[model samples]
Target: MSGHTTTFLDGLEALAASPLSPALEETTRLRLLDWLGCTLAGAASERARLGQMLASAGDGPAPVIGTGQTVAPLSAALLNGMASHVVELDDGHRYGITHAGGPLIAALLAMAHDPRMDQARFLKGIVLGYEAALRVAIACQPEAKLNGWHGSGVFGVIGAAMGTAVALGFDRVQLNAALAAACTSASGMVKAFGPGSELKPYNAGHPALNGLAAALAAEAGFPGPEDILDGPHGLIEMLRGSPVPPGALSVAPPYCIETVYLKPYASCRYAHAPVEAALRLKAEHGIAPADITAVQVETYGLAVHKHDHTEIDGPYSARLGIPYCVGAALALGETGMAAFSETALNDPETLRLMRATRVTEDPALSALVPAKRAAHVSLTLRNSSEVATQVDLPLGEPEVPLRAPDLRAKFADLARTAALSEARITALADAVLDPQTDPRTALSDL
Candidate 1:
């Protein structure tokens, strides 16, 4: 391959061979903790229970998250991946627009059952996985999403495969073969987020299943596409249309995980902006739910187009509806798991506000999306008062990240909700944050 054309292969080789820095390792460690909290919390959900049933057949050593039951490695990967994403609380990268930690962490955990994978190898695997997914995402860009393909489902196939390959110690050729296989498996429709969204979490699991299959296929010496990503009519061309960006393949250092966004709220990432705005208004003015007469949220195109639903009957739609999230944030001053609970769903005041709210796709804000993700909110009060606020970067973005204490509290909150004892929660958090702690031991208590 020519130097310019070899970007995909070169990037794959570099990330697979590169060692993560200590700082990045710590970041990875924190995200691991964050991921476990999401998994444990999600395991209690109805969706996660269904995932367990689907993956219940595997009897391998890999443990599905938050349960003592062991399943086959692939099943474990699928269940854990699905659980992590079920709550919409997993880590997300804006550029890639996929929750990277779900598939990456799930694949790595399933692979860790070998008892030979060290903590260092585990961390490196996650970095490489994010690298692969992020590169693919960059190439696809707005074009992929514009066409209704979910990046997590499409980009994550190769990413999860790469992580599995890293964990299994695959060489360049085997990794390429695995990626080729993954390309064949890439799929997911944004339609899953529409009405009757039960298939949404399954979209997250698809990558884990397909990715592991690709890696295992490579290890078994099953020949697959070697140039499936960059060749004519390859994965990129098929998904992104012709004339894809050259920079998409130009892999750089410091990796993609450096800017990963962890969730501070349980709602969709797209809704966080309005949620934050509403929360800020409530906090600053100390307004009760009854004090607000109407709310208007203006945001970017995708958020308005996909997330503008006014009625949220269940947890699934509650997590996806911007109107519900903003109303809940305004009413309760928070949008965590509690806000999506059954009680929260029946909240009369919140329902009233949700019904009264308006969400529109602002032309200016829409123009800035996939870049700024900004949102503007205007609230009208009962006593002839008005308030407005805007947020460019939501709280969990790297620019305005949750502090260490807040991160700890977030995890502690989820751990408690998952019924973990104080001792087990503390030990798990300690192990997850400690650079030297093995991932296997970190998960032992769970």
Candidate 2:
């Protein structure tokens, strides 16, 4: 399992042969549905304006998720992935910092709609992509995010390329070439979030497009390095600032599917635990919004970086703002897609709550994140009565997983905002759960 020997192609081969659990398959399918719903909602958003422009430029037969128009496969993946994450409501793996479902599902659906790709292979490719992204993210480890890179774009390129290669039935050599090309083309920066730049959504979309381009390039007789991930100028060295460790590319059982955290809240994953803690305290003590005087949240080191919003504004800002998310949860008793809206951000009560909320980094808690994402919140009442709640496992943690019912409910909630019909919602959920039944057929009705 030497790093050089364990190439992306090798990982893809292992994943293709790996046995997928029925439950895992169901999870993957449901995630697809959730991401599709997000994409559909974002199709008309100003955040997705770039995606719309790109979609209009292509005329291939690949279907965009919400829109009826078809574009080139790469173009569709880029647009769909961009739109899916435009609202920041898409699914993300907490540890990986990669929005697994966004790019992966976008590319899978674009390929799935192609008559040449059978449903079974399409589904398998999606699973393979998930595993690949997770592994690459893990191998890159702490440096993946610290080095001013977006894991979804850097590692996601590898995952999307591997997934697309699988769906296209590339031989091992071709798959290796595709991955090499992906490794070379992958690029994203964490700086996009710092300034509330429109580039944030492109972080999700660009990797998908690069990945598809990699696969297409490989198919068109391009040659790539056999050691793209471990070479001196490889992805790990360039993006991660270190060579990938030996045996870093092994594709194990369960993969990252078991470790992936489905987001229950639309905000940053770092903020979820604090919000959960606050919500738990509010629910248990029956604390009203006016009863809170101040709130203090102790979370990982990243919380300080995320919550330090002296100039927060707009939905994107709220989504990345820890104080805003915690305050909204405390004041509204919930934090969902609706809570990140412009109206919600400008709410007087939410601002008051945000002003009262203070966030700090706890080394002890910081050590537990990515795997745990734990947090502790302290609430002080108007009368100085204090209550504290700590959450080690939030709602969507791998251990405290969200059930099918909860996922369906979340889909419906998002659909309500998107104006999707009840029938459309049900059909979308069913088509994802049973992807063999042509999910596009359900989209047609929409």
Candidate 3:
């Protein structure tokens, strides 16, 4: 048993020391760009404003993303993580059901603040963090989610620790300790949905802070149970409330980050397929919102279970509601930030459409989950006409990846949405997209 644990830790350490392929490095850069766009766009939110205020009060070496403020490394990680996730547009993995980039990148930036940190090393850390954290998430998901736990708050902490360990050059022992310590603080609840969804960003922030602290503790000679990830009562059993699945911890991969999806809508990932379905119905059938009598949506059980609500209290609530997202997409032909704005949320027509929308679970679709985020949408018209569409996978999934030009356009739009000046947006874009740029300098100037 001890040897198994030792082998696991050694494998992780070796992954950290391994070199990334050119393709993997490119993907890392894109993920960074995506995270930066999300963080910068989210900086305008009240949550990010509060985070910046809290971090600005403290002084340290780490730069808080989307702000000119500097704070302690931990504080920076918390703030950046919060900002990145606040907009609900961060990149996410389908199988793991986790947003790996937000917290992992937050931790990496916090630890890579030193001018001497190599850009290659920082990028490698990003890749490693996603691999490790997402693997844990894959091992615990659906079950953990069904148990009311959020993977970002749980598995994300471990991912952050692994990434930080790589950045800080921690040995296998220290890495193991860091991971073990992270498990102690792994927690977040799915009840944060609906009107309480505004608190969801804390899942990313809390994990980023805790994961960084865990790695730092290990670096400072603190001891922890190395087998906390796989031993008795370890994170797998604790989170899943069952025995660890066989081979769940295996490191074999073409890089799990490659499978992560970049969000095309500013709503929960569960809502994406439905939104796409609705948009297709509107565009192809030329069905106006006024002409639609009612809508029925069938999707995977997890989506229907988590996002079926129509009673939206605010922007955050709107993001979590599949009914609202589908309604907005049908009504406005889009589900970007504008769809959740005060005017849109309060629009009587949109609300009426939302009320008329119904969501249900299709067992076939449910079984397809973690492999395909399929959705079926049908609309009945005032004239008794019917239109239907089914999306096996929404845009931005690995199979339907967003084009580089489109991704860059998204970044530019988000930067402008954050009220960034033209020059700053250009500079930030250049810095993030260029592999030769110093990460510390690229991050600090924002």
TM-score of each: 0.96, 0.93, 0.96
TM-score of 3: 0.96
Spell out the clash pairs found in candidate 2. Answer: none
Q: Write the per-residue lDDT of candidate 1 for residues 1-446, one digit (tens) a residue.
A: 54223677677677667677788888878888888888888887754465548554557877777887767888888888888888888888887787777887887888886655677777888888888887788777677888889988888877888887886788777877888888898999998788766777777787988888888898888776555766457877777786665566776865777777888999899999999988888888888889899999999887876688888758898888899888888776668889988888888888889898899988999888767899999899999889999998899888888866777788888888888889988888888887767767768535
Q: Which candidate number maximizes lDDT?
A: 3
**Candidate 3 deviant stretches above 4 angstroms:** 1-7, 47-57
Q: Which regions in candidate 2 have their CA more than 4 angstroms from the true location?
A: 5-8, 18-21, 47-55, 243-245, 440-446
Better of 1 and 3 by lDDT: 3
Candidate 3 lDDT tens digits, 270-337:
99999999998898887889999899999999998768887877888789889999888888776887
| Per-residue accuracy of model 2 over 329-363 as CA lDDT, tens digit each | 88776588778777777877788888888888889
Supply the global lDDT for candidate 3. 0.83
Q: What residue pairs are clashing in model 1? A: 58-71, 58-72
